[model samples]
Target chain A: EAGVAQSPRYKIIEKRQSVAFWCNPISGHATLYWYQQILGQGPKLLIQFQNNGVVDDSQLPKDRFSAERLKGVDSTLKIQPAKLEDSAVYLCASSPRGGGGNEQFFGPGTRLTVL
Target chain B: DQQVKQNSPSLSVQEGRISILNCDYTNSMFDYFLWYKKYPAEGPTFLISISSIKDKNEDGRFTVFLNKSAKHLSLHIVPSQPGDSAVYFCAARGFSGNTGKLIFGQGTTLQVKP
Candidate 1:
């Protein structure tokens, strides 16, 4: 079975510029997540979606970050007026369903470098 | 306050030796814990998991032990291989009001020498 897929694999933008990352989760997966992983740190959950509805986004920077899962199968995370601290890898993961104990499969992630 | 913590930043062990990675969490409501392995330039891959109802779970050469009272967990890999060299992360799932998200700990980098 194919795993989660992410686009660009790498990105670079100026501090004031905007950037977007795309993700396509595994087939038949019902839960999708977006995480920000700074260098030397673990991936931090920025947002989670159960189908087309958002399940959690408390840790997300509401001022500059936003994400959406249009059809509940694919997701996009965007950051506007990016800052240097946002220069981290954007990871996407998905699980079989929105349930505990299910292992999440992750994508290669997009390394965003903001100057 | 950090909910999850991995005190050891790195560990090195010889091939065929046992490797143990420790993680501690402050949240007692976390019911499901997991371990993920990640290589450079790659996203974390799920390695093993344990539920609160159980104290130990094993998968082949990998084992996870959870101590509920202390809110601590450890991942053990026996006869370690060079391929196991990577960063390991521990995550927990719990509900905070209306949201249920996995809280991750700082990773522990492991190197296996031949």
Candidate 2:
């Protein structure tokens, strides 16, 4: 089976510039998630989508970050006026469904470097 | 506030020896816990998991023990291999008004020497 797919494995942008990351989850997966992993730290959940509907995004910085899963299959996370601290790897994951113990399969992630 | 924490930033063990990584969580609502292994430049991969209903769960050479009273959990790898060198993260899932979301620990880097 194919795994979760993400684009632009690496990215670099100047501070205050806008950047976007794309993700295409595994086929038939009902739940998708976006996470940020700063260097030397674990992945932190940024947002979750269950079939195109947001399940949770409390940890997301509403002022600068936004994400959307259109058609429940492809997702995009965007950051505007990026800060230096936003330099981190952005990961996308998918599971069979939501509200269970199912394991999530992660993509290689997009490493964003804000200069 | 950091809900989950892996205090040990790093650990080194010789090949064929045992490796133990510890993690602590402060949230009492966490009902399910999981361990994930990650290599440099790669996303984390699910290693093992345990539910609150059980105190211990073992799979092959890996075992996870949970102490509810102390809010601690551990991962044990027996006869460790050099290939096992990677960062290990502990994650917890609970009803924080969101059923499937997970909170992750900072992570512990384990280096197994040959």
Give the residue spans of candidate 1 off by over 4 A: none
Which candidate gets the maximum lDDT versus the true structure?
A: 2
Clashes of each: 0, 0
Question: What are the TM values for chain B, all candidates?
Answer: 0.97, 0.97
- Relative to the true structure, candidate 2 reaches a TM of 0.97
Tens-place lDDT digits, model 2, residues A9-99: 9999999999999999999999999999998788898998999999888899999999999988999999998999999999999999876
DockQ, model 2, C-alpha based: 0.67
- Candidate 1 residue-wise lDDT, B12-94, digit = tens: 99999999999999989898999999999888888999999999999999999999998999999998999999999999998
Per-residue lDDT value at A83 in model 1: 97
Per-model DockQ against the true two-chain complex: 0.67, 0.67
Worst 10 residues of 1 chain B by lDDT: B94-103
